[model samples]
Target: MSPGDEHDFRGMDQGGRGDDPYSTLGGTRQTRTRLPDGDAGHPHARRPVRNSRSLITITGVVVLLIAAIAFANRGGGNDDTASPTTKNPGAAGSAPTAPTGTKPVQGKNGTIASGFAHDEQGAQSAAANYAVALGSAEMFIAESRQSIIQATHDPAVAQKLQDDLDTAYSPAFYKNVGLNDDGSTPTGLTFVSRTVPVGTKVVKMEKDAATVEVWCTGLVGLAGQGSTKPVTETWFTISQELRWVGDDWKISSSSQAEGPTPVNGDNRASTADEMAAAVDVYGGFTYAR
Candidate 1:
């Protein structure tokens, strides 16, 4: 298939429109007449001023109300022990999508993140990071692909997974994606393959094993002057079956699927130089759940 054609490597390494409320409503024109200053019918005619005592009473009532409101809104007691719902009042009963202030993994096996906690959150983090590794440009190369598989997969399954990936990312496949036989870009081109995790979910969790789905958006293709396979974005979700091995989570198996895609926006596409520069300047993240 051509580079533009949709292709999938099975079990391998893979906004809202707002309506204008006034649009349908017709604009109305109104006529207004200014009455004489002293006329009782005048909408802007002056009224009798309140007495000093009545003004005082009104001012006191206003002050009291303000004080009452302030007192009622002044949350008391220790903040650390407050429930998520209590702390974020209107978000009650809703799952939190914000970060929980937990630090990302501090350990690394070479460049890959390792030493995940033995829990659901850890599984999710591992899955996300592994997805990034599996979908990287480095995975197109033989040596790095094997290294990544070994680092991310369980010991028992690593060799087989590496073999599968090696076959999947063959020299022919590299050429189809506009790379050299050894998975290197041509002299004047920059090959971009990067996977960014949008979110992660744990499908199933147990004491020692977990299933996680990592939603990702990736860029893949060659970027530079006179390139036919221009860099383009793609969305995919990778499901990882993880097992707790040693002290970290390791992928036992992995598979990929097309995304829960979004409607494309009308933004102008960037040039090859711009995309290449962006990839070089901006660094990838270490995700934490």
Candidate 2:
């Protein structure tokens, strides 16, 4: 199978750096946007100030509204929202999944990890790992791409899926992504396409089938001097419908959606050379949870 030929594999590399969820809960924190110091269209523009009494009244009204909303949703009966069971649902740094205490997959299926359990935990693990593989830099290479596809996809659809992906990762697509004719990086450039899974959730689980959503931040494009394609990051969620196949979970189908994206932080973007060195030095992870 040609590597990266799957239409579903497109946009896997869209990424940008932000607050590391591992280091802080601030990745998804919202902050107030401050206006620029100088130009207000008029150099002598002055801000209007409200009275202290009026400001106090507004604050009191805002607090009451919040209290009322909290009271209305206080019950554990809101089926429209994901309940805060394992953790506070929708909070930054919260795990959307419940713990199963099951260990990660112990075995390997070629380059991909294998030996997933047949439960919801196993399915979530499989989906997360598969997202990393399908969103990898290796997917642009022919041999490694085939290995990834075979390892993560159901055998029944692997060949056909490979053909589809082959058609999708055409020469034009490679050129668009700054790859050479053979999917190799241009001289002195480091092609960066990696998916870092932030969290996983089993949206729907059954005896033999599971729908798992893996929220991820990805790094894509190229890093090098004179390179126009600078590495970038993006937040997205890949939802995979997995089936228990041949004693392990395999992707039956998958799709990606934009995000529950967090606000961009104020961190200075790294230089291209620094990004290239980082990609070369830091190996990608075998994400488990």
TM-score of 2: 0.68
Count of clashes in candidate 1: 0
Error of 2 at 110 (Å): 1.7
**Per-model CA lDDT versus the true structure:** 0.58, 0.61
Error of 1 at 188 (Å): 1.1
Candidate 1 stretches greater than 4 Å from native: 1-95, 99-104
Query: Which candidate gets the maximum lDDT versus the true structure?
Result: 2
Stretches > 4 Å off in candidate 2: 1-100
Judge candidate 1 against the unseen true structure and give its global Cα lDDT, from 0 to 1.
Answer: 0.58
Residue pairs with backbone overlap in model 1: none
Model 2, 1-289: lDDT tens digits are 1211122232223331222221111112223344544564654443332243332221221122112222222231213443344232233544555555788687998878899988767887899899888778787787887888889887866776676556556676576557787879899999887778888877666667777878878776678898776665556677676789999998766655445566555455778899999998999878775
Task: Give the backbone clash total of model 2.
Answer: 8
User: Taking the tens digit of each residue's C-alpha lDDT, what string does model 1 give over 100-132?
Assistant: 566547599988998887876678889899878
Model 1, residue 111: C-alpha shift (Å) = 0.5
